[model samples]
Target: MTVIGFLKKTVAVPVALAMTLGMAQADTIRIALAETPSDEMAAFFVALERAKANGLDYEWTAFSDEELAIQAVLSGQMDIGFGTPYAAMQKSKAPLRIIFQLSKLKFFPVTSKKYETLADLDGEPILLHSRGGGTDSIANVIEEKVGMKFGERSYVPGSSNRVVALVAGQAEATILDLSNTNKIMEQHPDMFNVLEMFEVEASDEALFANLDWIQANEEDVQIFVDALYTTWRDMNADPTIISKETNPDGPIGQLPPEILGSLDDFYTAAVKGGLYDPEGGGMKAAQADMEWYSEAGQLEGDPASLNIDDFWYMAPLEAAKAK
Candidate 1:
């Protein structure tokens, strides 16, 4: 072959191989959300941008519920699943590991214009979030802590519906999250009473993947976890980052003006209320989560029997923490 042909053969072959390798190395993680975008979900989307900057690319699919999301992750259909199903995980023997705790259950108990405290709730028909959900969990804790039992419990899903019941004088009391809680307080500032409630020091959501998937993609998992750690830390420091990073045309921004207007206040309240845990991943969180779920009747058996390492893998988060 001529010198020109030889150069072409060597250069072109190596360049093509390099392109293939680059394509193979471009780590793109697929994540599944348990539900549609809410304030916290939108905050995570903001963190996706941060994750990209750290060499991890992502594609996401939102499941209608946590069960489906967990199934998807378990089947290897998604790289990560949100809203850790601790109870389901143990029951089904899913080989999943929690690498990050997203947020805690930030709920508020709202009532009619009359009730003042947990004592006032005694012997009165009360509305609960669901038969067995975060709201009921809180209600159970309240009953035990204050030694009072509500007269009748009604299952009403959706904070808005429960809020409507409270406003319409249909239901006496119920629990709500930050957004709906704020919405209620804003619209009819004096009509209802948002009773002071205790903060559940338990995990509401988590980042988890199949154990095999995590073991195989350790670097990508670390990048994803680190990005989230940074996002939570930064958001904790400055709640405004959410508003700044939120796409004005995105889902959160497109929410009704009332909600959009109160976004800043909602986040400010969340940050101050300890919504996000600074230690995104740890054994302490894992243990606390197990205890809470056990008492709530969601998880069974001894909390001590459950191994934190089996459920929570903290290496990625420890690496991400900017200490």
Candidate 2:
């Protein structure tokens, strides 16, 4: 071949390569979280760090609540989100897919010393996270199991808020997760008592993404999922990693000095309380959630017939498990 022709071909090849690289660099994956920083998002933050190390570019947005997070994923405003709203699945018009289950928020009924059990709260007002959130669902199950009913109640919107309500004598009882429950009990040792710890099999947080986005960015999606599963494994393997990585000026760090200092203890207590899995894999938890939510009337179809395989893609998780 002529030298001139060869040079031209070499230059053309480099230009094409540059264009490809530019396109890949320009692509950004957006993830939505329900809050700025919380135990529910620990794995995700760790995963984001890992993903950056793996050459993946992502942006994160925090919504006020799970409903909004799900809406963001469904509307294509975000590529992925944390939280599982079974009701949204049965009710939303958008096509949202549950890519992975994060973890379960084990709830306990916390009450002042005056009350002891579910039945004790009959005709008494209680505080809940919201009208139709995880806490409300647990309340419903508790009522069913105890064959009683909750009386007049108010929505406090957050675990910390509910804890304050209970301590201030604003409400008789409230259901809360291990983290917040631990914080309250530790901060004021004598103010509250756990009435009972109720094990509700459900996914507190799940990786959700737009179906169309996944189909279009299959490779990126797979990589993101793989990093997330690996992060979960690593976080669970060493719970201290969360406290270490926590930014002193970041969300969790911005808590009052007292709360910030006790973060590590809170995480330790959470691990022991079964708030997280040592292995961090979610297949078993997902299956259990499928059954539990179905039984709780949150899911529209029977758990056995729900085609569990359709809800989650196990390839990434399986790969992480193998590692």
Candidate 3:
């Protein structure tokens, strides 16, 4: 079985190492990853390798979920992190600023065949990734749109785990990422159903950092963002580029050969599903985020009134595009 297939069977968290991309130094950016290494993050790893090639020094630690990753960045333990921490940013008034959108909110609500639509999920206990993570925000927006609240929310931390729960009959409903959603349906089409979800354009994941750190280390940040911008555009042009450019010794490449072989397939599906923005999701993403998060209850005030500059620092992305 493939590594992900094995993971689905055992519901295990994919292991991640504390990897440093270059010789450690006082200025090495410490990144807080929201989840362990998996196929979902292959493109990001390819970009990281490219940045390292261009003299961007960095290290990363994998947290169990987005909340922990956000806390690490907030507490000064990490220089950058991955998550949509709008609530934390607003409440803490920290100088947290998003630099690039990693992925859009392209999730699927998969449920047992018994539930036909979003309304049928009313009062149903649902499994999700984490308490305040992307899936949690999606659930909140779903409840608001459908005018019905979900019952007890069980946190599982990985989409594969949630898919396992759904397949094993441990969960009646849950949200999943594009690949996992496809995997389960293809494997057991008669067991579950993918509900028709409304379109979501806001970011599901993003690269954010404390403003002070970003200003203090503009060179490194620029290199990182530039590399990401190039990589994203290249992937959108030909998703197979991610699999081709991936460094064999890198985190993503160390996964089982089965997973490595499917990198092209994963990225192709991601791009087709609108999981990424070739432009790195600058102002358009920022505006969409304000509206989506407001509806998701993670941001207060009218989306129009919310100052996007308060959350997104667009200079790096703008500079990258100008090149």
TM-score, each model? Answer: 0.77, 0.81, 0.92
Worst 10 residues of 2 by lDDT: 2-11
Which of the two, 2 or 3, has more lDDT?
3
The sequence of per-residue lDDT tens digits that candidate 3 reaches over residues 38-62 is 8898888888888888887776777
lDDT tens digits, residue span 218-310, model 2: 777777777777666566667677767765543455557776566667666766666665444356776787777766667778787876655
Q: Which stretches of candidate 1 lie over 4 Å from their true place?
A: 1-28, 114-133, 143-165, 168-171
Give, for candidate 3, the lowest lDDT window spanning 10 residues: 4-13
Residue pairs with backbone overlap in model 3: none
Task: Give the alpha carbon lDDT tens digit for every residue of 1-323 in model 1.
Answer: 11111110111122112212212113567676665566656568667766667667565555555666677777666678887577656776668888898888788888878888878998888886545445666777788788898888887655666788888888878888777888889898888888877657787778888787787888888877877888888888988888788767545666677666666777788888888886684777898888887777677888888677867877788877744
Q: Candidate 1 vs. truth: CA RMSD?
A: 10.8
Q: Whole-model Cα lDDT per candidate?
A: 0.71, 0.66, 0.86
Give the clashing pairs for model 2.
none
Q: List the residue pairs that clash in candidate 1.
A: none
What TM value does model 3 have? 0.92
Off by over 4 Å in 3: 1-24
